[model samples]
Target: METIQRTHVTDAPPLPSPWRDAHVAVVVPTYNEAGNIAELTRRIYDLEMPGIRLIVVDDDSPDGTGALADDLAGQVNESHPGRMVVLHREAKEGIGRAYVAGMKEALARGADFVVQMDGDLSHRPEYIPRMLGTIMAAQAGLVIGSRYVPGGSLSAQWGRHRRLLSRFAGIYVNAILKLPIRDVTGGFKMWRREVLEHIGLNTVRSDGYSFQVEMNHLCEHMGQSIVEIPIHFEERRADSSKISLAVQVESMLTPFALRFGRRRRG
Candidate 1:
């Protein structure tokens, strides 16, 4: 694994990522997350962590997330050009495409590590350092923020139906795919740059939530170490949930096909 050492040199304007010289980029894929973009950007900027790059990819969200992202990028780049990038696609692509696009950007921008997570505040920014530690300590290719792990917990507000669905999905997918980790379907994860290259991300066909499962499977297949750390999973508080009935259907069906297809091939 290739690594870079970077230093944070200034405290004034010119927010250049002197530290971002390290292998790091945080990718936040958004679709109509206008309410959350400003605070998210602020939190990311205020965070003094080294080697962290913030890349926002928006799919032409009608709520103006793309414009907000551009504006935020402008504010940050006043001192640090290219520190932040906003990729705008014509329409809403699936989560898989958004992440794959972000991964490509991370690599092109010379990031050694890449992260995928929701923009809805469900994933706390404070957890980034901890996940980074897991990645480094375990020398794992991927570190997952898992809700099903021993120390993990889920919010109590979700209704029984939603809870049941997620539970069933996790159990079913893990069983079929025979994944070693507990949270095979979680989106909050950090991926080593090499794992993404080895996984052949181009081959992942899932367009919905199941994208996580396929990515995890690919990493495990490549003989990369994976760690699942306990995390508190919370439901999004703002903007409507994007997990529509169609998305749910795809989530269930996609895993079945991927798991079985791989079995046959193996």
Candidate 2:
């Protein structure tokens, strides 16, 4: 979990507009993110990215995040029809299941590209443009907003232990899976529609943050082109983290399962 020191970039030049009109879907999985969802929605729309859709998958949070998201989606659709969507699940499953549901919805809605990001605002909306541009420009099946790469950084608010744990998770997963990705555990990623269509989403088994690792492994296993871009990771704007001890345990054992278990298609 040793921190790799690198020069940070303050502003990234906006890539060209060749892919601006593509149907892009931002699939966010939320659990008690009410304090942050509205602002997140605003920032995403404010980008003015054409054909952009926000799909908020809520796990029936006690804070009524699902209702708030539905209200927000309704408000946005009045002026910009079909600009936002909210999927309310029955209970708190795991992030992996939430993402599977949201991704399926996005594809069914005709998303040309799919984005995975946290609803807590830790994954900035501004980076979406760069990620989209990268996927199109590089013809990559996936583009990752990476903190472990050069010019990428974590929140200064993160203490030593948290930082170490995050970094070690990626290193440990890579050591076992031997994937070429630098940020195997990162949640912020952009996927071409075809990649998701072929990744066998329904077959994925991990139900926690390890979902990120499994998806990366699947993409590599399927020989999909992948790219990484530097991003400054931020601390959540509000609400407590949803990560639990069970999630941690699942993440710890996921690599072994993928390596030796019969479910490597995940």
Please give, for residues 1-266, the per-residue lDDT of candidate 2 as tens digits: 11112233344344456577789999999988878888888777766476889999999999888888888888889878988999989988899999999999999999999999998888988898889888997999999999989999999999999999888998899889999999889999999999999987889998999999999988999999989999999998777787899999999999999899877344
lDDT of 1 by residue, 1-266 (tens): 11122333243222234433356788999998988887776666555565678899899999888988888888777777888899999978788889888988988898888988889888766677677767876899999999989999888887999878788888998878788988777899999988887776677777778788888888887888999988888778578888878777887887678756753221
Worst 10-residue lDDT window for candidate 1 reads 1-10
Task: Write down the lDDT of every candidate, Cα atoms only.
Answer: 0.79, 0.88
Q: Candidate 1: deviation at residue 50, Å?
A: 2.8
Judged by lDDT, which candidate is best?
A: 2
Q: Give every collision pair in model 2.
A: none
**Among these predicted structures, which one has the highest TM-score?**
2
After TM-score superposition, the amount by which residue 213's alpha carbon in candidate 2 deviates from its true location, in angstroms, is 0.4
Each candidate structure's TM-score, on Cα atoms with residue i matched to residue i, is 0.88, 0.93
